[model samples]
Target: MDFTSEKKEAENNKNTTNGNNPQEIVDSSSQLSVADGNNSISKEADEFRERQARDLKAGLHPLKSKFVFWYTRRTPGVRNQTSYEDNIKKIVDFSTVEGFWVCYCHLARPSSLPIPTDLHLFKEGIRPLWEDSANCNGGKWIIRFKKVVSGRFWEDLVLALVGDQLDYGENICGAVLSIRFNEDILSVWNRNASDNQAVMALRDSIKRHLKLPHSYVMEYKPHNASLRDNSSYRNTWLRG
Candidate 1:
C-alpha cells in the first residue's frame, strides 16, 4: 500500500484498543544492573550456557552468532528511558537451532501478546535501544502487517535471521515484533545506516523472504532520528 493508504489504516485502527496504551523507550543501564544482580537470573544464565555447550558438543546446529530474546511491557503513562529500561527483561539467549526452537516454543506468540508489548530478538551483545554501540549509527526497516497475519510474518523473519537467509546478514543486528492495538510491526535493524548498498540489500532480503506484495509499504527510520524525537515508529520515511 502507499503511504496514504497506510496512514488511513493506522487511523482506522486507532480506536481498536486491546485494553492497553502505547509503548515506551528502553534503557541500557537497567540491562547492566540485571546482569550484575545476584539472583536467579545469574544462575539461569550459567545453566543456560552450560546446556548450550552440551548441545553444541552433541551436534546441535550452531547459528552464525548467539541471540537474545527480550521482552518489555510499557506502563500507560511512563515514557522515559529509565522506566523503559526497568521494564525491559532479558528472557533468554540461544546459540543453536535447537536451542532457538526450545525457547521459541515455550513463548506466547505475537498475536497472543497484549498491546504495547514488544518481542525483541537481538544479537547477544546488542541491546534493543537505539543508543547501543552496534545500533547507534544504524536504522531499521519496518513493515506493518495486519494482525491476522502478523504471527506468521514474524516467524518467517525470525527464521530468515537465524537461518542466515539475508544477503547482508552480517549487517543485520536483529529483528523486532511489536504488538500494538492498531497493527503488528516487524522491523529489521542493521549496523550501518550510512551504507546505502547494505541497507537496500537488507530491505530486498526482507521482501524476498517474506514474499511481500509489490504494494506493501515499508518504512526506514534512522536511529539518530529516533534518538532526537524519542519515538520509534513516528516520522518514518515510506518505501516499498
Candidate 2:
C-alpha cells in the first residue's frame, strides 16, 4: 500500500489516472497472496504464498518458479527496420511475488497500453514464442473479455499461475494477454498439448479462480498448429 519511492519517481510521468505511479494500477487487482494481505491468503494456496509473510518480514519472498515478463507494441505508419523479436522488450524476471509486483508496478497497464500490444509472462528461460522448445509441444487456452473487465481476469490468471494454484505442477508454461483495439484476450499456456487430465485441471482451475461457471467457454490451441499455419491467436482446437 506504500510506494513512496515509486510515487516520487513517477511524479514526472504523472499522466495516468493513478497520478503517475504505475504501481497503483495493481492495487485494486493484485491477486498475489503477498499483495492480498495475510488473512486473505488461505493455507491451501501455493506454498510460495505460505512462506511469503515470513519472507516479507525478512525482505524477500521466494517462489517455486521463475518468470520473465515481456512487452511489445505495434505502431501505425511506422516501418521499423527491426525484427519483431528485436522490438519485443524483456521487462524483467522475478523469482518471488514481491519481486514480480515491483517489476509489474512500473509497467503500463493492459487497459492503458497502446493498441496492438501484448503482455507476456512466461517461465524463466522460455521465450514467449511457439517455436521455443519449451512451448512447441504446448498450447494455450484463450479467453475473451471486454477491455475494461479483462484486467481483473488477467490479474487472477497470472496469480493462479505463478502461485501454482492451478495444481498442474510444471506443465504450465506461461500466460499472455493481448490488448487490442476492439477487445482484450487472455491465454493460459501449458507445456503439454496432449495431457488431458492436467489440461482439464488447469482449465477448471482458471474457471474457478475467475469465478466462472463450468459452461463459460474457452478454446485451447496447440503450438504445433500455429507453427504449421504461422498463426498465434488462431484456435482451431477446442477443449472443455
Q: TM-scores across all candidates?
A: 0.77, 0.72
Model 2: number of clashes? 0
lDDT of each: 0.77, 0.70
TM-score of 1: 0.77
Summarize candidate 2's per-residue lDDT along 176-227 as a digit string, tens digits: 8988778898888889999988888888778888886565578888989977
In the predicted model 1, the residue pairs found to clash are 1-215
Q: Give the residue spans of candidate 2 off by over 4 A.
A: 1-58, 75-82, 213-215
For each candidate, how many residue pairs have backbone atoms clashing (under 3 Å)?
Answer: 1, 0
Output the number of the TM-score-best candidate.
1
Task: State the local distance difference test value for candidate 2.
Answer: 0.70
